[model samples]
Target: MIVAQRHRPSSSISDDFETQGEKSFLRFLTCGSVDDGKSTLIGRLLYDSSHIFDDQLAALERDSARHGTIDGDFDFALLLDGLEAEREQGITIDVAYRFFDTEKRKFIVADTPGHEEYTRNMATGASTADLAVLLVDARRGVLSQTRRHSIIASLLGIRHVILAVNKIDLVGYDERTFDEIASHYREFAKNLDFITAVPIPISARFGDNVIHRSTNMPWYQGPTVLEHLENVPVDDAYIDSPFRFPVQYVSRTDRDFRGLAGQVASGKIAVGEPVVVANSGKLSRVREIVSMDGPLEEAREGQAVTLVLDDQLDVSRGNILAAPDAPPQVGDQFQAHIIWFDHEPLIPGRSYILRTECDSVTASVTNLKHTIDIHNFSQIAANTLAMNEFGVCTFGLQSPIAFDPFRSNRVTGNFILIDRYTNATVGAGMIDFALRRARNIHWQALDVSKSSRADLMNQKPAVIWLTGLSGSGKSTIANTLERVLHASGRHTILLDGDNVRHGLNRDLGFTNADRVENIRRIAEVAKLMVDAGLIVIVSVISPFRSERQLARELMGSGEFVEVFVDTPLEECVRRDPKGLYKRALAGDIRNFTGVDSPYEAPETPELRLQTIEAQPEALAMRIQEYVERRT
Candidate 1:
């Protein structure tokens, strides 16, 4: 065995450690797929680095003899995973953390789970890690799960990655095998956000190139894993970033002393610098920065302090103090990426509580753009999100929130979705950016509101959307309903599909994308008419449930109703008034509903009437009666 080196110069590790007997700390994590030797590598690091006590080593040797993965030898994985279940199953379920010190530096390591079902646990560990040590099994090369964890590590803003090809002995320590695996990973990592990547060949089981250099691989000459870990630079980019302080609590112990207590999230704040309360746009000057020991002249990021302002203001929890010259974006709409955690699927139009940096707001996911395929980072169209799924979505908040992009500031950009009824955290999100329209278009204050206009007209404004198959008597019923509504002294307007197609939607075709656009235009027009205090009736074959739901969400609650005319396809074909159904059936036209294309019926409609059983006049009166009750 090689003896320990006589001197480990602190200068080789960092220039800052030149004057210190005690060293700075490094936080890192070990992550990869199952059976990739994450726990074993960390255990080996602790053992060979001389950080373990004699008693602990004795117990580890005894345990290894009793229960080892390999026959008649010590098992290092048992050191980190000490639970009975983990020893029995030989798989990690929860994150394991350990703290150790070396001659050059002090370190804390988090050993994360490798199973696909425990990705959230891995994410939780990676959130606070400054570096990631990604392991790969030499026998299996690279797997899909390996790429998945790498993508997540990049998304969490980890800049430095050390790719460790563990179990190199199993592959005969072949130099060609290591080079091929490293090349494949480097090529695939081109699109990721990592700053630097270094590959190291090590055998965790036999301690080859782990704590000391290995002789088996004579073709490779590089620093060992421990040597690399001791010298990698810790990210200090947040020091130059703009200052941000999110107030956590108000410390008002006495009438004369009131201060905001929180940690400085970014940059540096001086005692006399001007700061702005981001939520209310109020300005103030920093009077004092008080720590537990005494007052400080300035505070940098990560220092907890009680800030006293120059003027007395109504400050409370969830308020943010930021640099006046460059404040964070404040808006109610944002484009974000979310990782769903709950078993129940996400409802696009339902309300949930979104919490970020001690602030909570009522929020709804207004639109789902797509779900990502983690294998290749491809986008697939989706209407809902399920458990363990990643999606790109847009959210509408009840009030404005202050934040930066997640890539810039994780403290201000990350949020969690809480189930309103169960109080469970159901999803996690990272803000990509604030929607530009939400920032530019401010709500213009008006003296006359929609309610005031409706009051003057002596009726409630609403949209009665009539949808069904083609030639289902939707227009006939709409005509009768308009006549009935007008004779009752109510102002109304009918927006038929043919009239809309002739002018506004004339450019659209019968394709799915065109249908979505057609419904979007109609919804916007109907919203404007409702604002004018008119009862708008829309008659069309809006087949897609997603578009219909979009129209409902565009209006205020209870201001829109869906009425389905349930006429069988056979009956509609027999009474083909427009002859479009015959052409659709004969394959003369493509994307024809009920023939080639599919129609997603409404799960719950306000009214479903069998048009064959009753005349158009009777059905129209039935709708009128329901409208009168609702109004």
Candidate 2:
């Protein structure tokens, strides 16, 4: 029988772990299919290593009897599955992080959930892990989720992996079972760019070969899990790579003490070393490296220090300071691997907030290259990515950002896509490389600007966007509004939805993804019309609020006026002039807004025209009056 090791004083452990000396530390996560014993393995490690306190052990014993899955025995998984729901369901949900140390090295282990629904949480755990401990059930050789987690780990830059073949005792500790499973996994992980894939057979429930050698598996002659974890070389090569420092804050503690405050993401920086602001390409020299302890001569990777510059350059937050000769790439377009996390499919042309280390910008997936098939690792053509789907796509940003390829620098290349309206993280992406068009294309300077064109036309250029359910009198109101503006000597253009679709968007469909692209194209044309000094009127269903918000952002402040033609769905069905409502109701049409698809009504439209409240002409006059007042 295996016995728990003796415990060390908590104070000494804390001091040893927190000390910033030359001790090596490793960050790893355990992941696999559900019920593969990730939590049990972590708990066993914590328990057998004597990291559990007396109160915690006692609580585990009491809680095991209440929520135990091991027939009232000591359920090791109870230690890590802290959530009540997790305990009741006997599953891991959120990533549970725990820290422990042996005499050899300190470790931070993340026990990630194995459920397919929580793959995003697993990805989050892998994002910061240097090594991955992928668990697999002995009965099942390699599952789809196993391949998926492995791919995600590779994408997140984790090169070292330990294939822990768990539950060997359940399969009678057969050497053939272990060998076949390990062989299959190694073959599957061949293309993942893993530097090392070590396979170890262990029964986490019995604590066999977890912290000590197992007599039950005498045929398996290999180092135990703890031995491998303690001996594996921690990769610290980022310190030797190119220097990169993303300025998080500009310290202006009085004018005499101006400094750029941020952590050095990679490489070493010494005083008097020439650095360049990546986006602006302005050159300066590092005057001082100030740390909390005092001024330092040099700072390496992972060091938080304030850098005082020799020159008063135009630098601020969200700017990258890099070595003068090896500055990062600055571009507005790039190709990246995206792991979509939102329930709503990732729609191209729909804008999202792209947040990197210290920078935020409006970005959209311009094109979806293809999605990876987890079952066979094949590339399949797809226009949109669903939840937990992996795809390669081209992204277009509103402004240029400085970044390196993820392969060379994970810190600078990683970013997350946030839903602009909900402020929820929808996707995680890693930059592969910048697109050639980003470097080739440049905006030409024109002496005559939008203001000059509007002044010449003697009118304030704007886009009057009319959105509502289909069959709602949006087109009629837009036509009347444009007519009135034209009669008032305002240069005006009307872009009816059907008219534009007949030409500009002829190839587009009514799917959610297509609708996003349709609106994006119309918004761009409307922006161009406004730039030409014309008042552009757009009449479309424009269903999704996110797409409408995207249109609003493309225009100048107050230049995009949303006019909601508030017509009831019953009224829209009653006035089904185009026979669309009939077809949609009869199941002949799909993805029709107000029928099958969703139409997110404007929350705070500039003008809400209730068809029941007034006639079309009167509503048109109301919009005209509003625009005139704004002018």
**Which candidate should be chosen as best, given TM-score against the real structure?**
2
lDDT of 2 by residue, 1-631 (tens): 2233555444565675566466688999999999999999998898888888767777878887888888746788888999999998989999999988888788999999999889889988998898999999999979988999999999999999999999999999999999999999988888898888999999999889999999998898888999999988887859999899999999988969999999999999999899999999999899999999999999999999999999999999999999988899999999999999889999998999999999999999999999998777899999899998999999999998999999999899999999998899999999999987837667899888999999999999999999999988999899989888889999999999999999999999988999999999999999999988889999999998898998898899989999999999999999899999999999999999999999999999999989975788899999999999988
Per-candidate count of clashing residue pairs (backbone under 3 Å): 0, 0
- In candidate 1, what are the lDDT values of residues 1-631, reduced to their tens digit? 2222222233343433354575867889999999999999998898777556556666777777776686665588988888778888888888999877777787889999898878788887887788899999988877887887888788777888999999999999999999999998998887888887788999998899988899999988977888888898885658888999999999987999999999998998999999999988999999999999899999999899999999887788988899999899888899998888787667675567899987999887878899988767889998678877788999999888898899999888888898765687888889999986646666789899998899888999999999988888999999999999999988899999889999999998877666766887898899999998999999989887766876887788898989998888888889999998999889888988777877777779999989987999999999999999987
TM-score of 2: 0.95
Ten contiguous residues minimizing lDDT sum, candidate 1? 1-10
In order of appearance, the predictions have TM-scores of: 0.69, 0.95
- The local lDDT score (0 to 100) that residue 395 gets in candidate 1 is 92
